[model samples]
Target: MIKHHPSETLLAQYCSAQLPASLSVAVSIHVDMCPVCQAKVAQLEAENAKEVFSESQLSSSTVKNSHDTEEVDFGTDLLNLITADPSIDEVYEVEPVTIQVNEHNYELPRALTRISHGRFTQVGKLARSRVAIDDGPLRSSLLHIGAGGEIPEHTHTGFEVTLLLDGEFSDEEGSYVPGDFIWQDGSHQHTPLTKNGCLCFTVVSSALHFNKGLSKLLNPIGNLIY
Candidate 1:
């Protein structure tokens, strides 16, 4: 019942390997959970391969010969493109990984299991914690919002992407469930609220810029904290 999805352009970029590693990871996790997106990406890859091979410099006879084995070759090429690293499956099978918040342990998404152990910093009175991922210029984090918790109204300094992994949450945009991918930028501002708590994988190019009430005062230090 996932309604929200990454835009088609974003999916195209993902298929072409044009996104940042962090953004790509977020989209990959979403694509894994969403069969619709999965099919869409597969179709895009198929079309891309078709266009690529059509423009090849192979002789007409050579192309005709390859046509006999084109299906198998296309499948192999698509597999390699979608999964650039063969070790990803092995990593998933390594162990069960979880992120601990107080007495509770939440299982992370398969794409995130390996990196859940990074530094986790608690925030606010709610059971929220931010786990920072070192992605060079692109800042990413694991954001856990406790039940009934609400984040202060804020806008982004740059682009932001949030992929819900567990539970549900809502904002000015709409309610988002697991597998829903939310993309926002500097022009957008909203206070995210969770009724039954949620775990989200998020990536931000820059820090957030608070835009309301007492939270606005944090603007001076938002870049450092976010």
Candidate 2:
């Protein structure tokens, strides 16, 4: 039972391919695990397709009227070519891929299986593996929290998008399970903790601002470490 989800604006941007690669990947992973989002995305895609088709039809009608003897149906030709392929309806099997973190193995989403990732960097109870994606200022990574792990209270300098991949964690707001999408900005602050360990895919646009205790001192190097 996933409780959190990407906002409607984000979903629309995802369907239009308007999001940055890292954020897009986060939304995609959420959609993979959430049936509710899946249906919404499908509907958005259908609507986009219909709009494009309508424009194409209007263009084709104009072309036919311009050249009276020449009648060309671009949509039909394209559809025929696609349907002519013997493997068009065939489904291919995808090999399962998993990543190990904190001595625990968790399977990755299908969308992430092919993306390259760097070696894990460990810091206390947290481990991070950077996903190899170039999205300007956005950085994406897989973050793992060991059992009883507690992240210091912090706020984002820009924005943070987190998709829980496995296990469970709780913050000041509430508890989050696998497939939960958490979005945070400069206005939000919280300390996250996991009792039995958890794995998450995170995309951050900037460094975090640690708010309390000794962790606050790390602000100088937060951009480099986090």
Best model number under lDDT? 2
lDDT of 2 by residue, 34-108 (tens): 999999999999998898788667466523435566655667755675788988797768788988886799999
- Model 2, residue 96: displacement in angstroms? 0.7
Q: TM per model?
A: 0.79, 0.88
Instruction: Report the lDDT tens digits of candidate 1 across residue range 1-226.
Output: 8988999998999999998778888998999999999999999999987776664422222322355554333444545655987766653254667767645578877777666445556676244344445678787777778888888999898988888888899998888889999888988999899998888888888888988889888889978876
Give the residue spans of candidate 2 off by over 4 A: 55-72, 80-92
lDDT of each: 0.79, 0.91
Tell me how many clashing residue pairs each candidate has.
0, 0
